[model samples]
Target: MRKFDAIVIGSGQGGVPLAKKLAKAGWQTAIVEKRWIGGTCINDGCTPTKSMIACGAAAHVIANSQEWGITVSDFKVDLEKIVQRKNKVVESFRGGATKGMEKTEGLSIIYGEAVFTGEKTLNVILKDGGEEAITAPHIFINTGTLPKIPPVPGLDTIKYLTNTSIMELTKLPSHLVIMGSGYIGLEFGQLFRRLGSQVTIIDRGKQLLKHEDEDVAAAVKKVMETSGVTMHTGANVQKVEQIGDTIRLQFTANGENLTITGSHLLVAIGRTPQSTSLQPEKAGLALDDKGYFKVNDQLETNVSGIYVLGDVKGGPEFTHISYNDYLVLYKRLVNKEDTSIKDRPVPYCMFTDPQLGRIGLTEKAAKEAGYDVKVACLDMTRVARAIETGNTQGFMKAVINANDDKLLGVAILGPEGGEVMSVMQMAMLGGITAKQLREMIFAHPLYSESINNLFMTLEK
Candidate 1:
């Protein structure tokens, strides 16, 4: 039996930083990791995928260089090199995190899977055919989610690519079929399509992004469909089978049977925060209906000393949100301050060719929340920078409070849309009015300059 002042399960975004803080604060800490360090963002989800997405973006630029009056031809995409570059970037990030952990004093990293044996006690199954029993008065669970696979007929018999495994492929698929049309589906759908794959997406929902406003979702669908990607909305996937070298997928649309074949298939419906390993019941931790830990504003679970963090808590599963969880916990525990997860701004972006940056409420959400809303919209075709650069696609939208004229929500779907959305996010944080934005002087011929025009539509 071993004892430590604290134990952190899973070296994720939340656990790694919190573990380091506790050790630096003179608490002997041990962090257990089932896989690699630095969690999903470094190892699988964000870093490697974004690296590959950048490669796709480069290809897209060359393919459309004629619009810029530059003739580009005879281009060959080296699949091996693309995968190599992504791997190099991921390793660089992981190595830095590993080195930081090694340098921290009074901190131990155990390579194992841990579960609660009792309240504040853990039994870890070590990697080397060994076991260890460890206990601490305070324990943190950062066990994040895994990609979920749906139970379609014959799906188990044939191997299919996951978001993680798809990135490792050195050869491009002739045709790629994906199930689920959310962010993961659309991003990867455009990514491989730009890299010269025939891409098709199937979704059970009637729309690509059900959470977005109808107009915004329509624009996204148009952008993807206009780029030659096929979208089958309201699809019911019946089965999957591999015949010869080709993978076959069957679905029904509009009460009609349909079949499609592709060289690769990706099942990206959603992610599930599985409690199979952690055994939260052993700790008397209360979980919601969806299996996420029921955390209070301070991020504590039903068990007083055991706190839950990251995707396992289940509100917004973002890398930045996970890091914020670490901050909230640190301030409450170390600084003795009243920090919480209540009403923190959540900002997210979809890395398509024309990026989509979203913050705060949607127009539908604002109206549903009983706000008298004024909406401002500007198409990219109307923006000078977009017209001059020849990448004129997508639009920008802002929902304002009709009474106070303060910004309620914003959706930017154009080049560097995320950057423009960040400016608006600051506006919201500072309680800046729509009138203020219109009168504000922004550098001319910039994408963000459209903010002024956008509000001018509403005020004028």
Candidate 2:
């Protein structure tokens, strides 16, 4: 049996940093990881996906360069080379994080699967085919999540890909069929299409981004459709079967049965927390109805000396949110500051061409919350920068408190929209009002300058 001052389960953004902080604070700590050092974000999720997206973006730029009066030909996508490049990027990031964790004093990283045996005791099934017992007064869980695969008939009999496995393909699919039209499905759909694959996306919802406002969702759907990816919204997938190098998917939409054949099928529906292995019941830890760890505003579990963080604790599952979870816990545990996760601003960006960056409430959400709101909207085609670049495809919408003129929320769906949305995120944090932004001086012809024109809609 071994003991430590603290134990962190999972080497995710939150666990890695929290373990490092505790070790640096002169407390002995151990981080138990079932796989590689870095969590899903660096190892497979964000890093690899975004790297491939960049490759696709480059292809898109060259293919469309004719609009700038530049004639080009003989363009080709080296998918194997693209996968190598993505692997290199993931390797660089994961290597750096591993080195930092290895060098942290007073910290030991155990490569094993940990299962709780009691409130504060656990056994680790080490990678080397051995078991070790360990306990700690404090335990932090950042296990993140596992890919949520739907239980459709014949799904188990055929070889299918999840978001993680799909990235490992060295050759482009002749036709790729994707499930779920949310951020993950959309991003991958556009990426594969840009890489020269015949892409098709199926979703049960009528709109692509089901949670966003209808207008916003429609605009995104239009952009995706224009990119040559087929969208089958409001469809129910019945089963999938693969026969002799071709995969067939059958579904129903509007009472009509439909079938799709593709070289590959990607199941990107969603993710669920990895809890059954932890055996939280042994620790008396509480979980929500969705199997996520039940955490309070402070990120604490029902049991004392135990806390949860990152995607496993559920909320918005962005890499930034998981990193912020570490900060929130560090402030209270290390700096002894009174910080919380309650009502903190969440800003996320979909990495589509003409990215969708969003912060705060949507117009419908604002109205539902009983706040009198004023909406400001502007099409990207009217923005000088977007028009000059010839990549105008979407729009921006902002919701403001009509009574006080304060900013409530913003959604930007245009080129480099995430960067532009950060500008609004700062404004919301600083309490900058819509009228103030309208009158502010911004550099001419910048995407951000469009903010001025966006707010000007309220006056007209």
Candidate 3:
């Protein structure tokens, strides 16, 4: 058996950096990856998807160029070239991660699937065919989640795509039918629609982005609808069947049985943690009812020396959250500092045409938490930047504490909304109040400048 000071299973966002830190701290470390080097973010999720989104966005802008008084003769989406470009971006990122780890001393990259054989020992089934045993006192599990496939009848017989497999398509789909209207579904739905596919998004929930405030969700749905993306809410998918070259999806919506046919079906309902295959029971670890590792605020599992980080622990599955997991663990274990995952302001962005960026609590959440809240809203149509750029379709909203004028949360659903939300993220971090933001001098004609206008609409 080969032994190391630390063993990290899965070279995900948290694991990769954590492994490097452990090794640089002068401890021998072994990082095991079953498939790709950079996990989902680099290999399948963020990099490739966003690259395709960019292509789709460009296509969209060019298609509508006539509105800008720019005469365009003809344009067509080259799916082969788009796929090649996305692959290049993924390879570049993966290669960099691989090289970074390779250059690090005292760190070995084990290409295999690691199953816990004991509390401190792991047996790896090598990807290239071999077996090896490794033991370490400190074990970190960052084995992220995989796309969940719903148990729809006839689904197994048909060739359907998950988020990962869809990236491999070299030809644009004729019609794309997506299950679930969550962030993933909406982003890809808009992306494919912009890429010239007939896109339809179906959701079992009553509203798109059901977790958001009603107004916020409505605004997103409106933008998507205006862009020609069809939506079916309160839709319960009953079964799926392949009819020759097309797929027929049967579902019930609004008490009506309905069927939709499409060239491709993407199941983006959700993701499942990879803990089941890890055999956490052997390590004296238990998963939650939802299949995530039951972790404490410190991200430590029930096992004393074992830690669980990233999506496998299953809170907010964002790349930044995974990175924060590494920081939390590094501070506690290495710096001997007190830190936790509790009550942290989690920020996320959806890369839809007019992106949706959100952080902290929503108005509904603030009200539920018993906060005397003041809400402010500003339409992007009124923003100088939005009008100038001709992308005025969404709005910006801020929820503030009525008692102390403290900024509780913000949601920006406009062009470059994510970047605008980052500014608010910093303001919240600095404890800046709604009044302060309203009076602050922001650079003119920018999406962020709309924040000043947003807070100005608050009832004093």
lDDT of 1 by residue, 356-446 (tens): 9999999999999999999999999999999988878899999999999999999999999899999999999999999999999999989
Residue pairs clashing, model 1: none
What is the C-alpha lDDT profile of model 3 across 99-166, one tens digit per residue? 99999999999999999999999999999999999999999999999999888999999999999988
Q: Estimate each model's TM-score.
A: 0.98, 0.99, 0.99
Candidates 1 and 3 compared: the better one by TM-score is 3
Residue 411 CA displacement from its true place in model 3, Å: 0.3
Estimate the lDDT of model 2: 0.93
Rate residue 85 of model 3 by lDDT: 98
Model 2, residue pairs in steric clash: none
lDDT of model 2, residue 457: 93
Instruction: Tell me the lDDT of model 3 at 425.
Output: 95
Clash count of each predicted structure: 0, 0, 0
